[model samples]
Target: MNFASAWNAQGPLARQRREAMLARVGQLRALEQRAAERSAEARAVFEKRGQLLPRERVGLLLDPGTPYLPLCTLAGYLQDAREPDASVPGGGVVAGIGFVRGVRCMVVASDSGIDAGAIQPMGLEKILRVQEIALQNRLPFLHLVESAGANLMRYRVEGFVQGGALFRNLARLSAAGIPVITVQHGSGTAGGAYMPGLSDVVIMVRGRSRAFLAGPPLLKAATGEVATEEELGGAEMHTAMSGLGEYLAEDDRHALGIAREVVGRLGRAPTPALPQGGRVTASLPPPPGEGWGGGAPQREDLLTLMPANLREPVDMREVMVRLVDDGILEFKPLYGAATLCAQGRIGGHAVGFVSNNGPIDVPGANKATHFIQWMCQLGHPIVYLQNTTGYMVGRESEQGGMIKHGSKMIQAVTNATVPQLTIQCGASFGAGNYGMCGRGYAPRFLFSWPSARTAVMGGEQAARTMQIVTEAAHGRKGQRPDPVQAKAQFDKIVQVFESQADAFYTSGLLLDDGVIDPRDTRAVLAFCLDTIAEGEAAQPRPMQFGVARM
Candidate 1:
């Protein structure tokens, strides 16, 4: 029982065991020192690039003085590596649980200094494990991605494959209902693009970050098209064309700042009861045409303000600003010119806006889909501005799968639970009308300007209908009717549609709620907002679905 008596009884075996334990402790201390050195190296690389390392990013994302529970602490083995102690979890990616603005969040960030942040099969497994943690904990996920692509060199290793597991993890993350915010601080190419695409929000820095499914070299070799890195997948491409990025920052710091702000907005606890002494509808403006100094401006005057041709252009921003609050925060303004969206205070209450472009055939129908889905999740009212001639057509539209995309928009709007209010400015025709949350879509209130044109098709399509009718009227056996008289009859038929006015009298039946002046849009939206806010009781959080593209 005594220490010396026990040691003497054990003899040589006890001495050997004691020495082995000491040796193992020394080995652990050495490993710890190496890990520290590697972390410092990683931090130095980021500092040289004027950026924060993965650890620093995590710290910034989490609340001050919070501890991070790391998921893994070891990296995989690699053949022919010179340094014996080169591998560790910090070498691949740093992932853990932390608090962000007091809300628990799962944080995962790539170690850009090691292997250029290339994701090996092991690293993919680690990321998936972290995603699982987020799901289990019901914590919002944040991915600070700065990677090149899959680790091609690791393919030869046992249990290694070419396709990484990040894609599958992304699918699971989407289904878990944990909101993922992905930030691209540097190059994000090939497989790296999927992480950001799978998240609810993607933030990218202008000059420091880029994301692409294919890089320039591969593109040039495969298609004989040459492009620079920036041209291939720069901030402009994703933000303006691909619609993959939610917000564009001036630099890396700005991007991180934006990510923090977005997470705060999304993670705030729902208010169960109205604040004490708070007015129920203090911010709401009165109903349309009530307590007003002057009636809304005439629809004919608004028509003159808009562009003439569908192919031509006008700044829909001007129209939105005039209709909504003074400071409208338009989201994805540079992407999809035909679709417009924004989140802003409508009569001092947050609301979502989805609108159609009158000048282009871009079926912003998909934007409407995203808008409706967003509203359902946020539990906010939606305002739609309708001015579309119809969904885009022709070969280009077909190539983009306009029909499929347009259908999704229609389905989202019709199925949405949130209060939707639509205003028809001029033209609302074809499927575009329904996608814009039209009357048939069951908006709480559907109003149109006096000059609004509501129909199954546009005037040009109506002209064709008249032409076909006139041609059919003249049979082969009988002499053709007088050409001038036939033309006059066609004109008369078209005039009936023109004089129909607003959404009513469509198909020779009353369909619309009624027409309101253009200037009354704000008042209408304000009243709708108040009604929606007052009606709904507190509801449970939304169920997660497959990842949204943008």
Candidate 2:
């Protein structure tokens, strides 16, 4: 047969073949459009959650306009079975090289909508792959976690064999001194919590997030006790009681913002400023009021500024701001309201400030411990403002582990080698005094203000002691005096406790060096700093022991 005749005879099948090819091409194009739509929807969902998507988060965390090098564009293989979704990058765990605050960082962000962000067998492999990347590059690893848990069914099917490799990788990164920061944007339950907990810093948003060893249902089943998510693992729970996390945020955006700031602080090059001299001291405010002995300012102003009644309270933070440098950086500022610790430049040199609110005891001590630890790390000087009544006592105090935690503060101060300057503002008595880095604790210089009520106990205790003594004398003499006469006798004896027999008495005994004006505190600190600088430079080495975990 002729070639043309044969082609015509086969025309029906050829036409059908061409039509099939066209149909497949159209189908693929439609799929591409649908995928673009789905991605857009995913971005929109992230916006609704007040969070940036994983890719966008990576972009913002890195240096401006820096491009991210994705770790893997597809999930890894199994023994022989091909994963239907193997084409997806990282199998829903998006990991790659990025930057935070202009410093290089490696990131692994989970997309919850994808398999509920569960760590399937393949997912675990992906996580380990990224961890290896971080360690190899010597970059900080940032985890944006919103995971339900390991894929339980997949894990069972695989004989629970996928977790060890991932955890080993985490331990390796941790040992390398490459910091890891985890941001819990949503539910972090089951095995998921371990990923973040292993990190150096854990940042969490408020209502939209939770993190725990297990979810509520599992806990209820395992323990037969039902607890709300917040009770189990909320921001408040972690920040205040457990101290599992370093920072807490009101929302995802806030968490990310703090992450950026923290990365900057951690990654900056250490540049210690030069020590200052007498010229710097001269510029400081005058000492406390005239009554305290130093010629700077009056201690009486403190009494008037504070209410006479003990029940009335003053904001110690405002007092600290007025006394310290203008550019103070407060730590755990929201978690502990009663204590304030900050790092700032004093006389152009970095120093740590530890101050307390009279109404709050252990929190103040806790804050002080953290400050001292930070100072030790930086090899900087520390200044303590002692203004606590005493260590808090009561049912609440006991539950807070006040005694043990407060002891930690005292130990930290005693062990600190940095030049510690202590200013007794008011009411430094009992254990609280020693915990405040008292004179006995070997401060470089200990100065008390005239208004300082430094007794073995507070003024109220003095009044009580006087009342008891007078009552005993009256009973022994068999003489009942009028209320007026009794009042006079009690007042005279109580006055003994209030006068030089107090802090002034200690000063006379040389237990306390002397009192200084409150306003002159700045000058005094500057002078101390200059003196320390003249005698010796700081050791230039970290303390060997008793380092508090950050």
Best by lDDT: 1
Please, what are the lDDT tens digits per residue for candidate 1 over residues 491-510?
77677655553232331122
lDDT of 2 by residue, 147-177 (tens): 7776665557452456766656666666666
RMSD of each: 29.0, 33.1
- Go through the candidates in order and give each one's C-alpha lDDT: 0.61, 0.60
Candidate with best TM-score: 1
Q: Which ten residues in a row have the lowest lDDT in candidate 1?
A: 277-286
Q: Give the TM-score of candidate 2.
A: 0.42
